[model samples]
Target: MTKKIFASIVTICGISVMAVMLLITALLNGKTADSAAGHVRNESRLIASAVEKGGSDYLYHTDFDKDMRVTWIDSGGKVRFDSHKDADSLENHADREEVAAALKTGEGSSSRYSETIMKKTVNYAVRLSDGSVIRVSGVHSSFTAQLLKLINPILLILAAAALFSALAASMVSRNIVKPINDIDLEHPDAQKSYKELAPLLEKLRTQNSKVSRQMDEIQSRREQFSLMTESMTEGLIIADPKLMVLACNTAALKLLGAGDFHKGQSIYSLNNSDIFRRCLLNALGGRRSECILRTGGGQREVIASPANSIDMVCGLVVFIMDVTEKQELETMRREFTSNVSHELKTPLTTIYGTADMLASGMVQSDDVAQFGENIRGEAERLINLINDIISLSKLDEDSAPRENENVELFALAEEILDRLKLSAEEKNITVSLTGENVSMPGSRTILSEVLYNLCDNAIKYNVSGGRLDVKIAHAPQRAIITVADTGIGIPKQHIGRIFERFYRVDKSRSRKIKGTGLGLSIVKHGIMYHNGTVRVDSEADKGTVFTIELPIEKKNNEQGEII
Candidate 1:
């Protein structure tokens, strides 16, 4: 601002001074020319008077200045006398503008440039009373010559003026800019500056307030975003188009096994896996990408989505999810479906074959009864398989009854044993229920199912004359039930997966026993529904003991206890 003001002031001064100088020079030149012309007219009139008084002797005797010329012409247009040149050698004066006008008028004057002398000649002619003309001409420097003569002095004056203008411009510009520079931008309204700047200062105040509010709002939103991302179970990462990490959550760092992550570092610095790099690159290319990365922790699903603005990708928002559990669940679901199909097909096929034989009369009258019995038995197996599937589905989807009721473990065990009395008798197993009645809050139906399945499995796997014991007791914050049977015990290798749906320890033996393989699975799910735990202790050719513990309260009493 100071420099601009200084330049403007200097330019205006220089131009103004030059214009004034030119005007003065022109005015002086014009005045000097007029004065010289007047002198010529007066001199010509005086000369004409003297020539009229003394005739040709006055012009011949008189001496004039070296720059001045005198001539006398007769009415016949002939130069009769010349002061500077011979009268006979001079040209006819009647053809001259001043002389011709003087011949008709009383007096005339004219000016012309004389290239020979490089000066302007001013001529004045007067008609003499003797019927002749007397002319006097004076030569003076031209306007160009006068200006040239003044050039050195003009230059000296301009130099002095420039120096003065420089000083004045400096002082003036400083004064003009000082107030503006002194104003406090943070408190513009408090400054006593120029009244002309009041509006600008007010606007500055308004803009400051607006900017302050916007900054606060942005900070608030940033905090909220940070909170949300930090609290997420899924890992989240934000990166620029250059693949530089802008933000990363704790979950992301843990999921990707990236320790002590810092922002603005390359994302590859976190995990330089091929799949990670490929997904990010695809997002930068404006395409949404997803890939699974197997880290030490587990399988992580990385989803990179481009953040777009105006048809152009600006950055990337990446989500990393620990899909290890989800993938395993999906695998289990598929296996369950296949197993259910296989289990149902066998029964349906058996029933279909037996019924078809009976319907087509292929079986003899005596064998028809056996065929009908086979069909009925297969249909019953199909119905039991379907029921078990429905129960397992309900448990998987948490769609079972949630209402709890007080259930006595001892009484429930006795009831289950009574229901399986016929099966126990078929195996020649002696069943006994003992121990005090341990009461707990639970879903009655699920507990009953749990007790019934454990008792039924005991009888089915028992040897002839085996012993079955159902005992109920109490432990700290728990109601305990133990079901022990002298049966072909489960092998150690199969104990872990015995609770899985349709998992049979001995397939052929289980087929002959004629029981759905979902009994232990149902018992496991029912125990889980009551927030209880079940343990199996077994050895081949010996006996297996099933111990179940149900929480007395709805919630577990132990801290950090994993069921």
Candidate 2:
């Protein structure tokens, strides 16, 4: 701004100076031209007097004028004599313009000018008593020649004038602009300005006060808006009708996989998804639109709603809500219900069939015992499945706190192994116990259930003459229980779902295994109830290992209650 002011001042000053110079030059040139023409008129009148008295003899006797040309024309319109050239060689002067004008007007003067180079030639003529005409002419370079001759000096003068003008303009501009630049913006009222600016400064002071108040209010609102946006979990974005981003929260930025962006940039710079584009277009068209967007961050439901004012769409307010966890919970609930129904109905159906046969006396005496055994087996399976289901429900609900007790983990494992030794014998597998008698504080029932399930699975899946190993060890602050068996291990793809209720690794061998598929799931929930962690290691046709870890003491049992 300062440079612009200074340059404008210098330009105006330069133009003014050049105009004055040109005007003075023009006046001087006009005066000089008039003065020269007057001198030539006087000289011509004296020459005419001499030619009139001396007749034809005067032209031959008089000395030639060196600076000008004079010619004597005969009355027959031919040049009879000339001072500057041979008389016979010259063209007829009676036909000349000056001569023709003189013959008609008695005396005549004419001047011809060339503006291109600023040159002029003046001619004066008189009619003598004879039929011939007396003419006098002067030739000199135009004013432009004089100007060109003085061009170097004139340019020097102009350069000096421009320099002086520029310096003056610079100083003047400083005087004009200093007060404004020196104003203390933080305390605008303290400005010391000129009298002419008093009204402006007073108005400025009033306006400054209003502006300050407006800024404070805007800042306060901005802070409140920022707090509201940051406090929310759902993502929010505001956009103009052109789909240019006006504002967005941090959640929206993260959801769209975007970094810091400025306002008024097209939203396509953030996401070029066709569905998102359609939603934006629809919303801007005054129609609310929604889309499910999936990205690396998970699924989000994007809703675009138009903001309306005065019966017209003004902008769009988009809300992006994360629904990944909610969707997964819904799906799990559905699967759990279906699996529970199927698992319970299978056992109940078997028991009902057997009991119905027995009550009708359809079975012979010899087969009655087998039928009763079959009913009893199905009944036990049903009861065990029901118990497992109840325990799982309690864990999920985080119900009443269970009594915590200190139990020797190695002794508990040994007892469980002793009970499972017969099953191990039937499978022709060797059972062994290794590691220290690590004691941990937990619910005895849940911990024992966890250990028994692992050991039972190990024995059940063991190959003929395979080995079962139960290890209880102590870590820095944890009790580690590992039950490993050399058996047909789980497939890698099914390892992730092995702890899901009723999930079986091999459906064809499931019936031969002779146990509910809910065993591993029960192990998971029981161990989870005691504030412990469990991990599995397995290989196909090799073996499976279930490693359970319990804290030596309850470490911020955030799980709330143990069922």
Candidate 3:
């Protein structure tokens, strides 16, 4: 700024001085021309007086110098005599401007230039007393030649002016800028260095105060927003129209698996999914878009919504939510509906068929009891399936707080084993109970269901005369329950899926066994409600063992007794 200011001032000063110099030169040129013409007039008077006193012969005998030429012309436009040339051979002077002017005006003067000699001539013609004209001409150098003669001196003067201008401009520029440079921006009104700048400085001081306040407010809001988002589970992202990330929370980075993220980096680089990037770009194009991006073994809902201002999309705010549980629940609902429909349809069909036969008298007297039995049996199966579904629905809600009652684990196992003994006898399977007598804290109903499902499944899947065992024990921190059956065990591939609703290892075998597929699924959910884990060990044609572990809660630290 300093250099530019100095240079501009110097340039302006130099140009002003040069302009004045040029004007003066033009004025001098005009004055010189006028003086030259006046000098010719003065010299012409002498020659004219001499001509009036002497005849044409007296003018022809006088010597004329190389700078001056003398001509005498008669009133009839004939050249009567010349001073430097032969008078008889000279052209007529009647067509000359000065000769014609003198004849009309008595005295006239004019200027002309000779191209061959490159010089200007000034002529003064005065009319003689005999109706003749006497002309005296003088030659001078051209204007361009005069300027060439003065070039060195003019350049020397301009150089000296330039040096002075540089010094003066520098001093003036510094004075003009000194007040501004010395201004105390933090406290503008503290000192009055320059009166002219007082108003400007005060205004700056006021604006600075306002700007500082506004900046503080903006910074406060930013910090508040960051604090609020830091601990949020949902991912939040703010990006620009170019899909560059502007702000992203920790959750957003972790959600998108953005390992190394930075501001101004493209959001498309956050993930490998083409569709997700497309959604982000679409949001930038003034549209809201959503996509389910599977990440980290779970589903995430990526919603890209345009942030609009005055009906135009300025940027994007993407919200990512962990929707894994929601999506899983939806899938489970769909599967449950389908399974219920099919499971209910089969038993209802059987019941309807048998009842219809009986109502129409299709069964004879001997077969009537058997048909009635079939209808009752199908109805019972349908009832059990409905109960299992109701239990699963309750578990799915997870809203039911269990009873705060302690349950005797061994006693509950024994009771469940007793209830299943009759069924085990029908299959000729030996049922036995083993392990230590232990207890846990839980709802009695839920604990009963857990034992009954395990023992029932053991009996249901056991081979003819196969052995079934229920074991109960206590670990240092938990209670353990084991149900093992020597039966057609689960296939290794299907073992993991056995707890899913309606998942059968062998459909045909399950049909002959006449068991609801929800029994084990119910057991799994019910045990989980009590904070337990269940694992299975099985091999086809070998045997299967189901083991459960539930955290133990002792009523008294010293007593270690049940409540």
Once fitted onto the true fold, the runs of candidate 3 whose alpha carbons sit more than 4 angstroms away are 1-155, 171-199, 202-206, 271-274, 277-285, 294-298, 399-401, 435-437, 554-563
Q: Could you give the candidate ranking by lDDT, starting with the highest? A: 1, 3, 2
Q: TM-scores across all candidates? A: 0.75, 0.61, 0.71
Candidate 1 per-residue C-alpha lDDT over 1-563 given as tens digits, one digit per residue, 9 for 90 to 100: 99999999889888888888888888888999998998888888888888778878877788887778998889988988877888898777778999889989878888999766567999999998877888899987887778888899888888888899999999999998989999988879645899999999999999989999999999999999999999999999888878888998899999999887689999898899888888899898999999999999989999999999998898999999999999888888898888889989998999888888878888899888788888889899999989988898887677887866888778777778888989888878999998997888878888888888888888888899999998998889988888999999989998888887778888878878887788888888777787777888999999899998878977742221112
Backbone clashes in model 3, listed as residue pairs: none
Best candidate according to TM-score: 1
Clashes of 3: 0
Better of 2 and 3 by lDDT: 3
**lDDT for each candidate structure:** 0.86, 0.81, 0.83
lDDT of 2 by residue, 292-404 (tens): 88878888889999999988999999999998887776787788888888878888999899888989988999998898898888889888888878877777676736767
Per-residue lDDT over 1-563 for candidate 3, one digit per residue giving the tens place of the 0 to 100 score: 77888999889878987777666666766777787788778877788889899876678678767677888888977887777788899888878899999988888888888777767899999998999988888876666656666678768878988899899988988898887788888888636577877788889999999999999999999999999888899999898777788988999888877787787898877886888978887887888899999987589999999999998888999999989999997997799789889999999999999999999988999999999899889999999998888887787677546578778888888888888778988999998888887877777887788788878888888889899988888899899888999988888888777888898888987888786789888887777778778888989888899888888873321211110
In model 1, residue pairs whose N, Cα or C atoms come closer than 3 Å (at least 3 residues apart or on different chains), thus clashing, are none
